[model samples]
Target: MEKLLQGLIQFKETDFQEHRQLFEELGNSQSPHTLFIGCSDSRLVPNLITGTLPGELFVIRNIANIVPPYRNIEEYLATTSAIEYAVNILGIQHIVVCGHSNCGGCKSLYASEKEMQSIPHTRKWLELAGNVKEKITAMNIPESEMAKREWMTEQINIVEQLKHLLSYPFIKERVLNQTLTIEGWYYIIETGEVFRYNRHNSEFELVN
Candidate 1:
């Protein structure tokens, strides 16, 4: 907490001052180009990695960077509501669902039931990855080091969640009309490299 406050003080002294006009403009409203849905992993800092300024990206971070298909129910759902606002209200042009390497949430997939007993909510949340395990199983990825499996699962999971985003009527319709673009991205935390899944190649390729 102290470190964060110190960082804020530094920002106020430097970045905040240098970008005063930008901050002033941001105060009125935000007109970001993309909605960045990424993992809540501390290592995967979207703005820092993308080099985007404050108002350039609207962000929603969650465990495993999950993008559950939009739904309407009696209860209030934060993630779904955020999507509704970003697409319907804010009218963002793009949505990027990002996952990162060595994610603890993804790693939890391999945990024994007993190991996960305490995190019932998290286990339920990761039920979102139900199909991902099947995909890996059908492909017969050899049981190997935890790190390798987690990395592959993390990347593949991003693709799956991107599909989840399209489940929303608005996102699907706008995408069909060519007005909105949805992307699946993987950020390798250790390497500081980002890869975008290329639909044509069906593979993740280096960005630029």
Candidate 2:
């Protein structure tokens, strides 16, 4: 907590002063171009990874970076509200769902219900990733290769979230009209490599 306070002071003294104009413009209104949906992993800093400034990307972070399929948002509004605002109000042109290499949420997909009993809310939230497990299981991957299974789950989860995003009527309409674009991104936290899903090839390729 003290470290965070010190960082805040440093930002006010150095970084904030250096970018005073940028902050001033942002103070009035923000017009970010991309909506970045990524894991709430401390290691995955979207701005640093994308080389973006404060007003460049509007970001939403969640426990596995899961995008629950569009539904009537009466109860769960955390991620959904952000998505709606980023699209409807902010007019973001690109939506990128990024999943990382070693994610605790993705790791929990393999945990038994009893094992996840303690973290009920987390378990419930991760239920949105059920299809990721189902699809990977259908692939019949070797049971001995646990690491490979986890990696595959992480990548498949990104694609699954992309499908979820398309389930939104507004998002789909915008995508169809070429007003918005969606991307499934995989980030290697260990190697700092990024891969983006190529719809044409139906595979994730290095993001150059």
Candidate 3:
């Protein structure tokens, strides 16, 4: 927490002063071109990863970066609400769903229910991995290679969320009208190689 405070001070003294006009314009209103949805993992900094300055990308971070399907409910979810505002209100042109390698939450997908009992909320959140589970289970793969399998499933999970994103009426309409484009990405933190899923090729290819 002290480190965060120090960083805040540094931002005020250096980064903020250097970008005063940018912050001033942002203070009035924002017109970000992309909505980047990512995980709460400390290593995953969307701005640094994309080399995007403030006001360029509106970001939503959640545990495991899960995107629950559009649903009618009384309560609100930050991830869904962010998507609504980005797609419906902000009119952002691009939405990127990015999952990363070696995610603890993704690893938990292989745990038994009893093993996951302690982290009930986490287990609940990761239930979205059911789609990934179904895919992984049917593969004639070895347990020794489960982690590698999960990495592939992590990308599959991103596609699952993309399908969920399209379930929203407004998003579907906008997407059909070519007003928006959805991209799935996987960032290998260890290698610093970002892979963008090519829908046409149905494979993740090097981003650059």
- On lDDT, the leading prediction is 2
**Model 2: residues >4 Å from true position, as ranges?**
none
Report how far residue 120 has shifted in candidate 1, in Å: 1.5
Q: CA lDDT of each candidate? A: 0.89, 0.94, 0.87
True-structure RMSD, every candidate = 1.4, 1.1, 1.3
Q: Residue 41 in model 1: shift from native, Å? A: 0.2
In the range 1-107, model 1's lDDT, one tens digit per residue, is 99999999999999999999999999989998899999898998989999999899999999999988777788868888998899998899999999988889988
Which residue pairs in candidate 2 have backbone atoms (N, alpha carbon, C) closer than 3 angstroms, thus clashing? none
Q: Is candidate 1 or candidate 3 better by lDDT?
A: 1
Encode model 2's per-residue lDDT on 1-208: one tens digit a residue: 9999999999999999999999998998999999999999999999999999999999999999999888895695989989999999999999999999989999998899899989999999998999899998898988798888988999999999999999999999999999999999999988999999998988999977
Error of 3 at 167 (Å): 0.7
Off by over 4 Å in 1: 145-147
The window of 10 residues in a row where model 2 has the poorest summed lDDT is 68-77
Alpha-carbon deviation at 150 in model 3, angstroms: 2.4
